[model samples]
Target chain A: MFWSVTQSLLGGLLTTFQIFLFTLLFALPLGLILAFGSMTRFKPLRCLVQVLVWIIRGTPLMLQLIIIFYGPGLWLGHNIWSGNEAGRITATVVAFSINYACYFSVIFRGGIEGVPAGQREAGQVLGMTKSQIFFKVTLLQMVKRVVPPMSNEIITLVKDTSLARIIAAYELTFAGYSFMKSNGLTWPLFYTGVFYLLFVGILTLLFNHIERRLDYFR
Target chain B: MAILEVNDISKNFGSTTVLHKVSFSLEEGSALAIIGSSGSGKTTLLRCLNFLERPDNGSIVVRGETLFDASMPFKEQEKGLRTKRLHFGMVFQSFNLFPQYTALENVTLAEGLLAKEREDYKQNKKTICEQIEKHGRELLDQMGLADRMTHYPHQLSGGQQQRVAIARALALKPDILCFDEPTSALDPELTGEVLKVIRGLAEQRTTMIIVTHEMAFARDVSDKLIFMDDGVIVEQGDPKQVIDHPREERTRQFLTRYAQG
Candidate 1:
């Protein structure tokens, strides 16, 4: 039973890992750009971005995942993300990116804004251009400030990917539950906790190391 | 030509004017100490130099270049302001070092920015470490903060933080360095360490403008002094002439109230 559970869980683990990496690959950069949008000095752009963030953050992750994956087809009347493994993955990515992007945006906004206004002024006086000031002084500091909260979100994401099973994507947790349905083996369902525990443990260690490296900014 | 000139520069927040038709000029490489009571607009005048606060009237010319003009909007003058900012460095009372960055990162940021602007300016990225180490080391060494280079702002004392701020400002080798009440945040004992550092910079002939309340330090280090009151320069002259022997009654009264008791 344990052997069969391990095999099914491993397949689920593979799918889970891909979603996690792909989401971060797209989500991190998209979050930074959204952060800039929310921070834009132009009132219209800032207002528009803020409203979007309010919508995403104000809603539940479960509702968003269901709506984004299923809503597009119903609203567009095209069945765009059809029923298949690849299609499910695509929908999951879209939903996950939007939800995480909003969370990441708040973190990014706080980090960038938290950097003192004087540092940028000092940069300007030193003859650095606006872009230079951001990349050098502003962004460097923003990264350090954002890391703690960002790590929290990233670790949360490791668990959040399991939510993809809601749309029948066959992720780790789904694989564990499959054994109970097929052969009435509840142990396999409980064993899913191991996969989650290990992933979260690894992420905790990485974040701790990064915090140590930033000790200079204390 | 004066190295820097402020021609009738004024600024208002909403309807209340903080600076009004204020005009002044200073020579290259001179220490001009601006003294004033709270809300007297000393810092506002200094910020206008860097275009951090856009003036509502008139213009500021740096080294004979018209960086700001009320005739043009701030967006139109932004390029000139950008160019002008390259000519000076500002240190804040709060020691606004990028809190996430170490002292070394703060210093190299200036050099990196300049290198990026000059496109063909291929900097050997590998040597950047050595340069930061050398220059960052030297500036900190000069400010007596060599051991604290890797330390963060919150980790350092108020005086030490201000010293790092001064080091960060000088790292760019700017044509002018401005300080806004740099020692106000420090204790009296720590204040002297920062003042000593500034006096050393003055001795090195680094062009600077200091808005401060330390009357004795201002008198000792300033080559020229301007007393600002209610958004106007009420008095101006050599430190000895203006601070020691005031021509205006208000300046005299203000100095007597704050001067060493």
Candidate 2:
């Protein structure tokens, strides 16, 4: 029975990992784009992006997931998403990416701004074009600055994937919870905690390695 | 012919005028030093020469070409600002080297980026890169940083960082190199090394414009000196004459205060 429970939870962990990976793949670049949008010199675009980020960050991720998964069918009077496991997973990933991208953008903006203005001026006087300065000088420094805060958000993201269970997505937590409903067993729920700890432990090691590599400078 | 000419440059930030019709000219292979109290606009003038700051009303001409003209729209002036900036290399007081890059990478980065634009870059990539690396190393060696090329900025002393910055600036072979109080951030002990490098550059007839408070070094190393007060050049001429015999009351007052301080 213990072995069976472990196997079932492993299946759900796969789904959990997919959500985590897909969210990052979409959110990382989106966060940088949003960061640029928030920092744009043009007042209108900056204001618009700031408002969008504010709205996304002000609300709860769980609420966002529910609304995105169900709102399209409710408001439009037709289900835009197909009623299948893939559809539910897609909605969850979309909600998670948008939610995390906003948080990541704030971190990115802080990192970018924290680099001294003199660095950019040095690039300018070296005859570098603006984009060249951004990529070569500003971006590399920003990666160093953003790493600690970004690691925090990424670890938080790992735990937050459990929120997908709310919309009946059969992720790790849901798999652990299902045994209690069917077999009247609660130990598997405790087992799920171990999986999360191991996942977070691996992430901690990876972040430590990255932070060490970046230590070559600061 | 003057290698650089600044004709009536003025800059205003909102209602406060920072530079008031400042004018000066720099001859090729001659070093000019600008000495002033803080807020006297000496740094702004150097920045204007490097196109780091746009003058509200004036023109900057280098090598008989008008690089910036206030009569042109700001958009038009910006169009070629990057290329125009190549005419002058700048070193900041903070030694603003990219911390992530080693001294050698910092020195070669700009040249390597510019080389990518050459039509023959694809066919001659290896040779071009090797040439850039060789030049970068030579400049670093000239700055007395021969053994420290692989060290990151944070690993170097303030004086060493400034030397790397000088080497980085020289990597581009700019017509005029500008320094904005390059030694101001260094310790008194460290200032000598940086000054020695600048003095060597002067001896080699590398054209330079320096904004500094090192009055004695300015007097010895510069061909011409300018004394600025309240956004204008109060006195300028032979460095020895300007430092030893001031022609303006403000210049005298500033010198006396500097001497006392």
Candidate 3:
């Protein structure tokens, strides 16, 4: 029975890991684009992006997941995300990507702006085009500056993956909770913490390695 | 013909005028050193030539290419200004080297981009990379940073960083170079190292315009000198004549202050 529970929880952990990876894969680059939009010289676009980010960040991710999962079916009378495991996971990923992207964008904007204006001027005077300056000089320095904050958010995201259980996504937490409900067992539920701890522990090590590599900027 | 010409350039910030009808001409392979007190608009004049700061009214003609003309719509001038910026390299008071790039990468980054701008270079990636590496190394070697090329800006001393910045500027092979008090941010001991490099460039007769308070170096290295006070040129002539015998009272006062201080 214990072996079976372990096997079942591992299956759930796989789903959780999928959610975590997909969220980061979509959010990281989307956040950077939003960051540029937020700081763009074009007044209307900047304000529009800022407002959209404000709304996403102001609301709870759990609420966002519920709305995203059901809003299309309820409001439009069309079940875009059908009652299937893949559809549920897709909705969770979408809601999480949008939510985390807003937070990451704020960090990215701070990091980009934190680089001294003189550095851009230096690139310009050396005959670099604006895009070249942004990618070559500004972007790398911004990455170095943003890593610590970005790592913090990513760790929080790993734990937040449990929230996907609200949409019946069958992630690690849902698998653990099912055992308690069906078999009157609590230990397996507690075992879920181990999985999260291990995941976050490995992430911490990875981020530390990244920080060391970026240390040359300081 | 003059390598650079600034004709009646004027700038105003809000209501107060910062540069008033500033005019100057620089010959090829010559250095013009501008000296002045604080708020004298010397730096503004230098920045205007590179289009870093737009002059409200004037024309900047570099290598016979009209970079900025007040009559042209500001929007249309951006492309020309950017393309022409290749001909006017500038070194800032603070060594603004990209902190993430090593000295060698800092020197090569612009060269690689400028190369890629050409359609033929896009098809010859290996050849372009090799060419940029060779050119970058030569500039760093000239700046006496041969061994320091792999070091990041933060790892190097201020003097070394400034030298790397100079190499980064020179990698473009600009028609003229401009320095905005390049040694001002360095320690007294560090100042000599940067000034020595500038002196070397002067010996090679690189066309340059320097806004500086280093009266002694200005007299020693610059072919022409201009003393600016209160948004206008109070005096300008051969460096020795301007330094030794100032025609304007403002220039005399400024020189006396520098000499005593």
lDDT of 2 by residue, A1-218 (tens): 99999999999999999999999999999999999999999999999989989899999999999999999999999977788878888999999999999999999999999999999999999989889999999998899899999999999999999999988999999999999999999999999999999999999999999899989996
* Candidate number achieving the greatest DockQ relative to the actual structure: 2
Tell me how far the alpha carbon of residue B243 in candidate 2 is from the true structure, in angstroms, after superposition. 1.3
Pairs that clash in candidate 3: none
**Of 1 and 2, the candidate ranking higher by lDDT:** 2
Worst 10 residues of 3 chain B by lDDT: B74-83
lDDT of every model, 2 decimals: 0.85, 0.94, 0.91
* lDDT (10s digit) by residue, model 2, range B1-261: 999999999999899999999999999999999999999998888888888788999999999999999999878898878889999999999999999999999999999999999999999999999999999999999999999999999999999999999999999999999999999999999999999999999999999999999999999999999999889989999999988988888889999999999
Model 3 chain A: worst 10 consecutive residues (lDDT sum): A123-132
Top candidate (TM-score)? 2
Candidate 1 lDDT tens digits, B59-177: 87778877789898657877556666767788888887777767776666667655555645466655654665688788888998878888877888999989988988888776778
On residues B1-261, what C-alpha lDDT tens digit does candidate 3 reach at each position? 999998999999899899998899999999999999989998888788777888899899887988888878978778655678888989999989888888999889888887887888868989989989999999999988999989988899999999998998898889999999999999999999999999999999999998898889999999999999889888889999999998888888888888889
Model 1: CAPRI class: medium
- For TM-score, candidate 1 versus 3, the one ahead is 3
Interface RMSD, per-candidate values to 1 decimal: 2.3, 0.7, 1.1
